[model samples]
Target: MIHTVRSGETLFSIAQRYNIDPNNLARINNITNPNEITVGQNLFIPLSRITSYQIKNGDTLYSIARANGILLNDLITANPQISNPNMLNVGDTINIPDVRKEIEINGYAIPSINQSILNDTLEYLTYLSPFSYQVNMDGSLSQLNDETLISSARNSGVAPIMVVTNISSEGGFDGEIAHKVFTDVTTKQSLINAIKSIVIDKNYSGVDIDFEYLLPEDRDNYTAFLRELKTELEGINKTLSVAVAPKNRDNMAGSLYQAHDYKAIGEIADRVIIMTYEWGYIYGEPQAISPYNQVDKVIAYAVTQIPSQKILMGMPNYAYDWVIPYVQGTSAKTLTNRQALRLAYENNATIMFDTLSKAPYFSYSDSDGREHVVWFDDALSIGSRLDIVTKYNLGGLSYWTINNFDSANWAIVSDTFRIKKVM
Candidate 1:
């Protein structure tokens, strides 16, 4: 359950009302300071229910349970404070337990991610993919310093997945390099062998291929590469996961979408992470990174080709602050979700929710007297995205990056679902 902090409410008071230990409540919600909770902040109550209901006049436990379609005994078990069920009380709240579904969660972290942040995130993840090992044209890999991350993931019972991408040092995905590796059988074999060696040498449970930007003509070639890679990984008892661009239809015209071949890739890989975010990018116009409407279109099309159980919808943990009157070639400054929240508070900006996009945004002026708009994900937005998983019966969720810890995201996720641990 998620509880919004009202005026003059302390963490202890909230815990007392829920009949939970103050320390346990704090730890579950990742609240470092019990007194620092502010009004309008959402805190997880660690209950099984979706929400709590207040007892009103003529309300009995049995009536309430029946109204909620729950067994009376189950309701009683959820609320232990009501010592006398026969007696009626007004204005008292009781726990309402909602059955939580089990789901798998995958997170990507940079090699240089802070150790403390990784530790806090590992507890909720089933797989951790370090971003990334750059795949070269000659099939030789540019290494990432992922040893520490892999060790930590194993210790925390999270599967460490090796991520291979065609991202060059010059920046961004290199389409030419991907074309060379995909079309040339020799180079493709070498790349597969290199990937296998690393997966075994590093004791990775699987590999995540995140190649992007390829020639439209090489679509079949790309699919063949994934098919071979999947075979080799499976031979060694490992898994293969691919990250593809968000597209709503076959033969999507963009270079990013054309070579993805969602149907073929889904059939080849163990898991497919449909990158549902990034409609609003750094250089793009200001908007929600993963608007529910656009993301829904992608998922609706994705399920038509890919098996629902093999799809892992993408989630973004970052936010963009764009200058007003955005220029086409200009870039927006990237901020972590938590950083965005702090910026809003420091700027005295009143955050507003967009009902159409199902996103949160705010506007503020900078020291230079320049206006800016910041769009980010809050608990409500996160919940809306997670609902897609339940609605589509997806395999689970794959976070684009998890280098930063957002308490609200974890709070809602932890309280609403039982995280499945494959390790």
Candidate 2:
């Protein structure tokens, strides 16, 4: 359940009502200073399936259990108020356990991710994909220092996925490099062999191919490559997943979208992660990173071409602070969800929510007297995105990067869905 903060409500007061420790509540909600919760902010009340159902006429424990698809023994255990199992009174109320659907949660992490951050994040993830092993020009993979990540994931029972990208050393997607690997049979085979070798050598559970920005002509070739990679991974009992740009329709014209044939890749790969963020990017005018309205359109179109169960909607865990009078090429300072809150607190900014976008933003003037706009995800916005997962019946969600941990987001995630573990 989600509780909205009222004018006089404090975290301690909220905890008291829930009959839980205030510290635990703060930890789960990422409230470092228990007094910092803002009005209108949503706080997850970590109730354990405590939904109530009123007893109707002719209601019995057995009937209630059967009707709700719960075991009779469990029903009795939940309603310990009843002294006799055989007796039931009409108009009596009882607790009904809310059922949570199991779904996979994937997080992309950097090799240089903080050990403490990774440790805190693994518990809520089904698969951890380190970003990434850059795909070299000759179909070889640049070495990734992922040994520690893989080891830690194993200890935590989270599957570690090897991520390969068509990123050149110059720090951008190299379309020429992708074209070489996809069109040349020898290079393609070599690339596949390299991926398989790393998976087996590193004991990785799977591979996530994130090849971005390819020539429009390479669309079919890209899908063909994924098909080959999937076959090779399947032979070794490893999974194959792909990350594609958010495109609302097929044949979308853009370097990022054209090469990603979602329908074909969705069929070939075990999972398809639709990158739904970056609409509000570093260089662009400030806006919500993953606006609900925009994300909804992408998922709606995706389900038409790909099986909903195979799609993993992408979510951003970061926020952007854009300077006012935004220049076309000026860069926005990036902030983690936690840091965003801290900034708002420091500035005494009353965070505002855009109902249409379902995102949180605020404006503040720095000491330099320059006005700035900050847009970020909060419990409410994150909750709205989580709802999309269930709404689409999609496989699950994948965080773009998990280097930064957001406790309230995870709290809502834990409260709403069960994270399915492969191990």
Candidate 3:
């Protein structure tokens, strides 16, 4: 049950009314300063399978529980922080836990998003990571002022992670530049120092390292860089997270896969986000961005190397429309799953679902009679992926992007599992 702060309300006062531990409430919301809350701020009053209820002129725990067809003992257990079981305050709210399970949900977004969208989504997320602050070869950090997004996340009791990438100005990760930045002494110090300053200045919860496509030989160097950064971040009470490519072995060979040492990275970073999607990429052949079979293989191997509790399986929310009889050098046009379904409806095409991949798709011929295939994730695919998280006992699920959201996805998530709120 999510609660909005009103004028003169305090965390202690709120926890008492909800019958939950004040410390637990503070920890979950990351409220370091309990006296710091202001009017209109949102605070998630977490209780399993619980719904919010307001007290009336004459209401008691026994009466409330009995009215809801719940046991008095169960109701009391759910509200441990309630000051008095017999006394009820009129206008105060309470929670009735229906059933609740804890699961983490993380999202990545850019600064261009408005506060209205953040207001809608932050309530459902555990962490809202700004797209990035690019790390330059010269050891400088590119700016991405996401103050509004950061404030929204914090206000909604969500942690806002600062993403640092080794992407160049041309808008792609560069191997040579990353190799140099990691190996050079002066430049490396400049980068780390700059990151520390930004994290402190921007009031970020943590730093998510998203350096991709480094030289395979620099695997150890990259790991060392993270180790150093972790040591520094810890001193300031900040966390360190790393994004890695999906791999099926200890060391897979490829520019994309080889540089990511899952085992070593898992040991160093507080959270390890495995980029499990992209079986079908923008330039790749038509296939599920995240096929169940492929995702299973990746998780089967990931759990062996990294602890299941820290792994966040990444999934894509969009679809791709690829022309059939594909050429090697062609790219697929991206679309939201809703858009894809709309296209199929307009063209009178039969919607198809792959039994194995558990994704939805359809084939249609355009005006010129060119056949094309559209594949994307819908509620079913999202639900199946959620199953993977529970089956493996993994930490949670991550969206490579929340820029293009599907309403079906959030509804499925809320219906399936209780989200773990960690501010």
Candidate 4:
């Protein structure tokens, strides 16, 4: 439960009313100035469930819900506007209704159609990228392969989303070229044609646009493009979603943040997934992958701009381990949260959790005798972050990449809330 500070209410009074200790309340909320609570400031009130599970790669709502003996409807009611009920990606969080029950967990398979993996773990699956707008000159597009993945997803009761990225190459997204194409009128028209052709030709139910690293100057252009895209897609009863940088407010100054106008995107898209994870990342300063305190700040500011109902928080299923006595420009190595824990155990290092940051970190020396510090998420850290969704009443969450899977994260989420699925 959350309470917005009202006029003339003291922390002590509020805690007494809630029957919680004042210091406990402060600690949970990370409130430094408990005596000076401000009006309109939101505070989280701890309930019996203080944490939740984070959906990882290979997780689905159906399996998670069944494992917890939760009805699918209960999960859907918890989160509305989930366009595809059977599809879940990495970083998605499904609420676990029963913490103590042993439940089945499922995830969608991406390639080689791993039936054995699917049979073993995934209750539902989603095939990505079979439906996408292929760029063409003269405002036209050509259809790509469609039948195989769709057939696979449907056969397993999994729903599929048309994943379209601004990928000039086969592997990843290229934001620079996308900005050029979207900002140029002729190119934009051609892009639209491609989108229309793909939607019509492939019979996709929804579209997911993953455009990244866009220039700041193109903020208005990006907003305008999304608006037009939404208008076009809505006419046919199709859903539209755009991936955006996680930002606190509109005036956020970074190139990535500036181009993604949350307010504008929220108004235009059916769902706006905030790419929240990345703090502890490869090529980044060693830190917690998604520090709870940092994420809270972003969410706090985001709620002010976009409606909580339209926001889908982003989660990271990966972690990073950095060698210490660091060079000025050296990068950290990417590690799974599970791997991070194993490393700590293997190296005989003690794992420590940060109260203020709500992250986990440990220090150790590598075989080469180089000192290192590793920070990452665990069941505890992931649970703490998921709590923000319920406290803030967010729409849902999205994952960065679901290639790696984690079991403990799923267990915690399955215990707290039901995973919502789209009908």
The number of the candidate with the highest TM-score is 2
TM-score, one value per model: 0.84, 0.90, 0.78, 0.68
Residue lDDT tens for model 2, 1-423: 667777788899999999989999888877889888776566777765547888888888898888877788888888899999898888888988656778999999998899999999999999999889998888998998999999999999999999999999999999999999998888888899999999999999999989899999999888888887888888999998899999999978889899888888878888999999999999999999999999999999999989999999999989999999899989999999888877877887777889999998988999999999999888789989889998989999999899988998888988788999889
For 1-423, candidate 3 gives per-residue lDDT tens digits of 446566678889999999988877765543556555544344556554548788898888999998876788888888887888998888888888765347788899988876665677776799999999997888999888798888888888899899999899999998887898888999999998998998899899999999888899999999899999999999999999899998888768888888898889999998999998999888989998999888988999999989998998997877899999788999999997667756765676656668799776778899999999988775567778888888889988788788765655666677667788876
- If the candidates were sorted by their lDDT against the true structure, best first, what order would they fall in? 2, 1, 3, 4
Output the worst ten-in-a-row residue range by lDDT, candidate 3: 35-44
lDDT against the true structure, each candidate:
0.87, 0.89, 0.82, 0.66
Pairs in steric clash, model 2: none
In terms of lDDT, model 1 sits at 0.87
Candidate order, TM-score descending: 2, 1, 3, 4
- Which residue runs of candidate 1 sit more than 4 Å off their true CA positions? 1-98
Which digits, one per residue and each the tens of the lDDT, describe model 4 over residues 1-423?
556567778889999999999987765543545674544344566556523467777767777666556677776666564678777667766555443322112232344444453342233222232434434334344354556655555555545566565655454455666776776788787777677666666566677776776788888888888888888888877888777887766787777777888877878887777778887667767777788888999999888878887777887867788888667689888887657766765676666668877877889888789999988766567778878888888876565554555555544555555555453
Query: Whose lDDT is greatest here?
Result: 2
The TM-score, computed over Cα atoms with residue i paired to residue i, of candidate 4 is 0.68
Of 1 and 4, the candidate ahead on TM-score is 1
Residue-wise C-alpha lDDT for candidate 1, range 63-92, written one tens digit per residue = 998988678888888888888878857998
TM-score of 3: 0.78
